[model samples]
Target: MANTHEMTVPVTRPTAARQPHPSGRRLTAHLASVADDLTALWQRLEDDPAVAFHQGRAWVEAWREATGANLCLVTLEQDGAAVAMLPLEIKRSCGLSIARFAGTAFSNENTGLLDSVRLADLAPVTADELALTLSQAGLGADVVLFDKLTPATAADAPYSALPKVFHQNPSFQLPLFADFSAVLAQINGKRRRKKMRVSERRLEAMGGYRHLIGEDDALALRLLETFFRQKALRFAAQGLPDVFADPAVRTFLRILATDRDANGRAALELHGLELAGGDHEGEIIAVSGLTLKHGHVTCQFGSINDVIAADVSAGELLFYRMIERAALAGHKLFDFGVGDQSYKRSWCPQRTELVDCYVPLNLKGRLAAPLIAGMIRLKRVIKTSPGLHRLATWLRGLPVRRQKAAAEPD
Candidate 1:
């Protein structure tokens, strides 16, 4: 059911955290790459309301295709029947092998073990047993880190028992009403309408603009590239890191945007605003990638080209266009994904908190965990403290000048 393609890599490192009985009769765990055996369970778990789009079949397949990351399917069995599963990617962090959920990054709002409820209900020894099992299974990871975990996962057992930190930035959400007018009321309706009209007039006077949903694969890929460029420019302007810098990530976006499920719904959909004809003819000013699932619309990524029309507020206008569509289509929730930007807050009155769960499997992990946590916490501090954030932003913007000055040599 997952359309799986994964290869289990051999564990070469010494098992530093193995248990005396890694495979106890009552609780045995095995590792594999293929998920075909767990298709039924995957389907059942996916049907659960807590399962987000990131873990859906199509999204997983697209990710695998894009990066071809090493996969580890850890299945736990109780009395010969499967009871829990963990889908992990074996990655190298520092000198340690790190195990993380495949879709940990890229600002997705969810990641959790497939058997959250069951895993939590497992015996008290399950946590230690799991660590030993992971070591024996050859995942070769010193620790397991599941970031951006939903509330359900955070409230559950083994994970809940482990160290966790709340996400620095929670996801912002806008609740949709029966109509666009009603939805606009959540924010200042009249002000928004006037702003929209102003934006439309500016764009209309410049030439003409059109809202588009990229249904065709070719067009979608083109808009995705535009998004990349705009985002890079935006990040550079803001002196922020560009997370979409990876080539594999671009391929990943392309695959997801083009892939449609049996119901003809795509796991990722691309939408944009394009200038029909003007000085910058056929240029896309704004782009938004979204996923529509269970009547919810979550924006995965978005960008705007202010170089064309700064006064037009193309990004906000594009959001208005997208949210209006979601409202008209009867989508209940419009999620701005993970971040707390002023624009997102201006429209969203709801927020979803995320948790980062960390578990140290061995001595190496025990030593490294604190350093990692410290860095995360430090980042959070910097983000929350306006003075520190401004200072950091200034430093980021100075790297280029610093390099140039250093090169000038005495």
Candidate 2:
């Protein structure tokens, strides 16, 4: 069984005196002084349909434990009732104080918590007011960087009202059907079917294989560790920086994988492919980590023992099985997340556009904004062009050479 952390917070205003806005709607923003304060606001936000698992209390708590950053919760109030909340983290990045959405390293999608009824009637000016208030909330941040936001999320009054730079990062999603066959029928062309059949045959020759869904926290943690090791190998082979190499990131993932939600389901689900008999018999050859919420199953990361299961395409096979499992479990959508991979396109027909918002809080932030925007634009260009991307990968793969030290004069 996974560990459960029940969050409980008392609803109260900040200790500092709050002045009424000119429009008569009191806007009070403060750093959540304690975990309980955040828990209370998070519980209230849970009632709103717009809040995703990424912005939930559990996810934020995991992130806080992994990265010890200051938590700032900004709330907008009307008639002494909170209408919206923005959960942010303040940290120093690139020599400047910055505020960013919490859990950016692991969250696939993010949005602010908004009161549904109020959101429906929110005016453009009011949205702008909320954004302005957050910028000047005295969080000691020079700028705000909001990333991985979809249009539906950004449409929330506060985000929509902000004057900021935008960048496009597209994500993919597949609308699932009642059965696996129905889902397969839509994407399983002759070539794909042939490949899948070949993979199945190859795996069968290797003494059979089984797809295993972890049922306990211990098993889940073990599988997660295997995934991290496999991912590290993959990253090294491809000359890419291993984000999971950081111990903090691993700790955060473990917390997520071992935490249970209200329904007794682990917040992070782990699945693996195990060989029944072979040189690597009883070992998990491939693994996938995912999260299920709001009728959607989002694939977070996956890894395979390419050296041992390359012929069978274990990673893809595992995904096929997971998709079937998700459909059988009544998930309405399978999201591949934000990436432009040929494999993702083969499965997900729907594309969601994401945007990044950069808000300058002071004169220093204004001066640094363009540099940051330019870097993002350059990365987008490199990621989109096949030749450039390949070249970049090759360059990254080249080992760094150290120059010989000069000999001392005789």
* Residue 320 displacement in candidate 2 (angstroms): 0.8
Which pairs of residues have clashing backbones in candidate 1?
Answer: none
lDDT tens per residue, model 1, 277-365: 78976889999999876777889888998688878998888999999988988889998888767787788767666777677789998
Off by over 4 Å in 1: 1-28, 113-126, 239-241, 397-410
TM-score of each: 0.84, 0.86
Q: Point to the candidate with the largest lDDT.
A: 1
Give lDDT tens digits, candidate 2, residues 1-410.
11112212221111232233456545555555456766766687865656767877777878888877587776766555677776788888789988877887677787767787875554443433443566666667777777777766665555655433334346778778777777776675455567778888888888889888777898899899999999988886665777898898899899989899676688889999989887878888999988877777889888999788777888888888888888888889998887778778777767776766666677788788778777777877888788988987777655411111223344
Off by over 4 Å in 2: 1-27, 126-128, 164-168, 189-194, 394-410
- Candidate 2 residue pairs in backbone clash: none
